[model samples]
Target: MLMMFWQLTIDANDPARLARFWGQVLGYQPAPPESDTTWWAHYRGRLGGRDAFDDRIFDPDGRKPPLWFQEVPESKAGKNRLHLDLYPTARDDSLPYDRRVEIVDAKVAELVELGANVRRRERGDSYYFVVMHDPEGNEFCVS
Candidate 1:
């Protein structure tokens, strides 16, 4: 059988709020309200309303995998084994290296204004990327 990829789920103290943060960061939107309502009902029924928190953000173009946040009591304690790498350029591969760097730096600054913290920046002979943490400390890269 062929394998299928679905959503990427993350643990958060506040699923809805975290989802909103990631939604803005990725230019995504809340998974359609009808879809979310159905899922929420199912979750609440299955869990007896005890641990029924779930929120999802979807790419506006329906291309990228949806991101899910589920409420959890425990906090993130360490770095992520897997992290997202974002390319802020809008399919503009023809941009010069310096311009690409400028775009990336501008995006990093914008994300910082939206509550992300810059961890570090890596500059190579041919490329550069910035490591940053989300509001809840999840590390992601921007290039």
Candidate 2:
């Protein structure tokens, strides 16, 4: 037997709204309809108040994993148990600290314009990163 990566699900107070924000951040698109149903038409019938509006985003090139946002009744209460670390180099971590910080600042500025709030900036002996919270208050890092 083999296991495969599918989707990463996030809890949100407004799933569709969060999905749009994340789609912009990740340069992803709405997941295509599995059959003949549009995404909204599919989830429309299932929306039952706060539990409604489940939405997913996909990499346009199909190279990255999909992300699903599921609506919940309660608001986010604290720090996330796990958070994403978005590197400006995308996966290259060998850049020098000054260069990395420069890239990080550029990306951070963009995200801030898109509604992300910078929680703080950190500088280590040999590294730099910025902590930011999504519009819904989910924390993630950029470096």
User: Number of the top candidate by TM-score?
Assistant: 2
RMSD of each: 4.6, 5.2
Residue by residue across 57-143, what tens digits does model 2's lDDT show?
777666577788988999999889989889876656677667777888999999999989999999998778899999999999997
lDDT of each: 0.79, 0.79
Clashes of 2: 0
Residue 13, model 1: lDDT of 88
TM-score against truth, every candidate = 0.77, 0.79
Root-mean-square deviation of Cα positions for candidate 2 versus the true structure, in angstroms: 5.2
Q: Name the regions of candidate 2 deviating beyond 4 angstroms.
A: 33-54, 91-94
- Clash pairs, candidate 2, are none
Backbone clash numbers for all candidates listed: 0, 0
